[model samples]
Target: MSARVTLYSRPGCHLCDEARAVIERVCTEVGTTYDEIDIDRDPELTERFGEEIPVTFVDGRQHDYWRVDEIRLRAALGG
Candidate 1:
């Protein structure tokens, strides 16, 4: 099964990098994995998340943008 958490990001984005770290730490603690999609790879994605490169989705619903909230993520996962 795919991971419940999805991160939309692009290369060389400092905020994206920070979001990844938070997602990684939270997901690991919750015993779950996450999917990272590079927006730069898809024009549609790039347009959709142009300003919000570090967007995060939980359970197929948009959760956060530009940053990943560790406490909220852990709570969402019921960890």
Candidate 2:
């Protein structure tokens, strides 16, 4: 089964940028497909994850926040 990862982020968020970079690298290494969501574009997402702009989801479940835990993410992807 393929893994689907999603990154929730917003503009001007350094942590979010860092997390996205990490996710991009990991996705490339693991050959997984990922998408990034700008929470600011959606009111519900903004409200749900405003304080935590860099939330990550793996296979539709909340995975991490603030930063991308590479070890944990690798495990999640079965890498």
Best by lDDT: 1
- List per-prediction Cα lDDT, in the order shown: 0.93, 0.90
TM-score of each: 0.96, 0.93
What's every prediction's RMSD, in angstroms?
A: 0.6, 1.7
| Over 4 Å off, model 1 | none
Task: Report the poorest 10 consecutive residues by lDDT, candidate 2.
Answer: 1-10
TM-score for candidate 1, please give it: 0.96
Tens digits of per-residue lDDT for model 2, 1-79: 6549999999999999899888888899999889888998999999999797699999999999998999899899888
Name every residue pair that clashes in candidate 2.
none
> Lowest-scoring 10 consecutive residues by lDDT in candidate 1?
66-75
Which runs of model 2 end up more than 4 angstroms from their true locations? Answer: 1-3
